[model samples]
Target: MNLAVTAAAAAGAPLLSGDKGTTSEAAVGETLVSRLGDAMLGLGSRLPDMRPETLGWELSHALTDFHTCQYTSLAVRLPRLLQAGHALTSSSDSPEPALLLAQSYTLATRMLIKLDEQQLGWMAADRARQLATAANDPLAVAEAARNLAVLGRKAHWHDAALSVALDAADDPALRTAGRRGAAQRGLLIQCAAYTAARNGDRDGMRDLTAEAASIADALGGTTLLRDHGGGFGPVTVQLHLISAENSVGDPAAALAAARALSPKALPSQERRSRYYTDVATALAHRGRRDECVRALLTAEQAAPEETHARPAVKSLISGLLVSGRTTSELRGLAARSGLLT
Candidate 1:
């Protein structure tokens, strides 16, 4: 996905530059977010054929790529979209474009939630709220609130996250699609559980997760939030399991789950690198220093220029250096891999 971002740069220029005024800018921003969302969904649709481990690796890397790029794009595009929507709202003009603009802002808000940027994500959510209100679309408003809930989870704003989730779960517009609404509620419950776990409320986490799992079962095992407007599947549950395991300091369990989801042979270079890097971390946590080094070597070989600079990879190196048991060997390996050179 990071490489895709680089490839998308040239194509994105025309989309970025064609915005002549506030309204045009908002329109374009909406198109861009929608397009990106569609692209992600398309990628996900192809996942069934790939190995679970490989699919997991790709998802992880794509999310990392999203984290890297969403901030810059939001900063450049969001204000213009908001201003344009506001202008249309204040005027007694036709609300069609305003409604469309609101939907666009909502899409952007969803994208921002995925990026792990708290403040900017909240700002985008606020814009989405205002646009939805102006457009008189209760469904859009509910969806925006749900997105805020997700952002709050990422930011560790527990009370705010729970409130937003509850509000979304109760929104009447959510009933438009019965199974989807239930699935969305289930995912929100999972998010709340995750937040509870982070706060060290074990009972709270367990209770919430249990309820979410029950709802997911009732919803036929779809766990992804419907507000995101994509098909939710088992991967959602697997990711939640991974998070739960990690929160409990069960690196072995986390690794087992991750390994079960990753592909045997990564379909993309980016995915191959990420998979090996994760394998390194899991091995390191398990005290398998030599195996960890081997995984790191593979990651470095896969994407020599970019993978070595990854924060996770760097952190792993630092941890190993401080451990005192494998510093010399790791240093030698790093030199050979050109990571230290």
Candidate 2:
């Protein structure tokens, strides 16, 4: 398992330029996400080859596609990756195969959640958790826990989500895993903070966010474990704070937090897109109509597939069109998102 090589390759893949794609590009991407959802849920009949020889490399490229927000590519690749991962894990006694399988499922869970496929998302997340526990890797288990917590939040089980995150953060093994442990724990805490905000516990949100920030500060400003998901560090913490503030109905505070972080400091296109989208959300909530549109446009420019294919983002675009005098750019964004065509 040459994880270093895998990480380097994934990191070096080129970012898809969001400004260059046409409406057909987004349409194709949306189709891919839909197809993948069907395939994962056994609605698709064709199965990928069971050959697991390239499992490691396949997982790396799939992860690169994921972080780059190249959903079309990822959607095309993941069915095969998941198929091969399952085959290998079932046949082999090695923990390494199980860990890889868990990671692969975790990626699928994250993508399904983004596409608003909650039913399949929950299934993938649970599978990842079971495999992670089987592999006996604390970091992998913590990541699975974070995904499950996210699904719980989406299901509106706010208290359960908070508990999942807090328990993962408190794991004795995770607490002892050193820098990697700290990074994972910080992410779990960040999750708990957002769950708190969703449940309307504003003070708890702030306190937990602060606690996560302290962990990031102790990491000395370096982002870590990006290949597993979005990296964790100070910038990521601030990004979460923006969304948390918005969730708690403080759009003004959300915008303030947004202003404090430089988008270029974010580790991946996924995080960068999230930063701009959060800014857009805050602007919209504050009734800054034009500014909100501009922020969303910036998010699309950062990662077109992420912005275009996101259900929440499309809803935001639809809301803008419903209430205001539509600008040319806003209309174009709607067309690209398949809402206007």
Candidate 3:
């Protein structure tokens, strides 16, 4: 989220073997081209050896930044790291950098989906899959599958998403009882939960959540294992429930779930913000205008950029405002959100 610090030397970036600006595959073609030029050309092999630790830290920070709704900054930063990873891979046959690159693509896939660029999201997920496969790493493949499942869900391919999640969850790599298996298992469960929600299969949603909750319980409540965007704990299971209920048009259940758990239990600012946003959406659906506005205001306080730019948030604000829900508090928020204009 730090737009002020984009210097390549400060962050470990990957080197893509291909020249810059060669393709316009991203949804916002020109915008992405411009961003990628700055993003990719600037990020070289900042570390001569490009150690996995440095890449991991840089990637983790980048992932956090993306999660916190720093899209513009990510647009200007991720390409550098991705291309830098490619450069490392081409220069040497090391799997570490490639694995990191796959992770980067996974983050990119998620971010683009949030940005509502599912076409580009699919491309990013595909790249992640290719890299993960080449690396021949089980965790990486699971991560790739997770990304693909999300992209499929967003694209309204609910059945495909469910298939991907189930396949990844059943993978021998993720079946074992260990740190990696636990993380991947938790991630796959959430993936299946959301996809089931999209399909409006209430039982499927609950079943998947129960499965994930068991993993969280076995892991002793909340453990932040740096895999699949850090949502594998008890708190995350609850958040997933809120999201699932919301997706399936169960506003009452979504609100109930949101109210039952403390946002304090959520691991990151991003998740906290999203929880409030979902609450706002459910409130809006339930015709509780004032509460909806209040929840959105709380979400904005958690992460202003995220709340402002999120499609669901924007849509909810616009809908309430357009419908003439004119409480003073709601109008104030509407003005700030540019909904009144």
Candidate 4:
């Protein structure tokens, strides 16, 4: 994981500044991308040694950083490099460095889906799948499929996500001992839980979430590096618990669990926004309108570009806007917060 993180950090460094077509710049970028690939391979080999807790934190932070860097790179750096790579390389043989680039793109797609960046996520996912397939690696394939599931969940394509996760779960190569086979089961359960939650299937959600939590606990000492798609980690499991508690109308417990998770420590704005949104929803359910509004404000502040436009946030805000006790205050806050454009 540290190697992957280091590679990610290094790969994200600015390319040598000059003409994009220059031989010198193209060589430099190729070298950097190759190094990044070597680092990812090294990290992959060490994943079996990682504990689940450490893996969770590593994956969470690494994926988060990976996404952020991709967003920046795609918007600025990728196109130039792609053109340069095409001009500089004529061989059809897939390079080891290409795998790292593909994985990074896959991770970026996952993050975009999490942040509701639908179109971009789809594009990135497609490229990742092609690259992973070319690499002929089962782990990479499973990872790409998992990213697709993230997109499916975000787009409300529950059936699609379920199908993909189930397929990944059935892959024999991904069920190795060091990979923690149960973790794959947990991913399937999470997909089921999300589908159940969307359909208001209380019993289904409860049963599936419980099963997922159990698997997560069973793999408690593992790191996320080995099975990136496995759906167990402290922060992620806690997040599932919070969602379940809220869905079951247990606001007090939901709030308590959310608070206990220390949302403030999350480095990604996307994650922070999600935590705050849950807190706001729970507070609102308890009729703590002021507190709810404040939490909502924090969420919006954390990721202003997307939070204000999110369906759930909009729905919650609409509810608060009609509440006589808080409508005026909310309007004032919206204006001051620059959220009411």
Per TM-score, the best of the predicted structures is 2
Model 4 RMSD in Å is: 11.9
The order by descending lDDT is 2, 3, 4, 1
Please give each candidate's TM-score.
0.56, 0.89, 0.82, 0.63
Reference-based TM-score, model 4: 0.63
Each model's lDDT: 0.54, 0.80, 0.71, 0.56
Error of 3 at 268 (Å): 0.9
RMSD of 3: 8.1
Cα RMSD of all models vs. native, in order, equals 12.1, 8.5, 8.1, 11.9
**Residue 301 CA displacement from its true place in model 2, Å:** 1.1
- Candidate 1 stretches with Cα past 4 Å from truth are 1-103, 106-116, 136-139, 221-230, 259-284, 288-341
Write the residue-wise lDDT of candidate 4 on 223-315 in tens digits: 354425323555666676677677666779889879788875554566677788888888888888888889878876676533443445655
User: Model 2: which residue pairs collide?
Assistant: none
lDDT of 2 by residue, 78-138 (tens): 7767766766777888888888888888888888888777888888889889998998988
Question: What local lDDT does model 1 show for residue 165?
Answer: 75
lDDT, candidate 3, 1-341, per-residue tens: 11112111111123233334232112222344344444434533453445667777778778877666554455545766676676677776778877888888887776666656676677777888888888887877887788889888877899989999889899887676476678678888888998999899999899989998888888886655455555577788888899899888888999899888898877677788888988877887787877878998898888776665555565676677666537777666555544454
* Cα lDDT, model 4, residue 159: 75
lDDT of 3 at 20: 42
- Candidate 3 has a TM-score of 0.82
| Highest lDDT scorer | 2
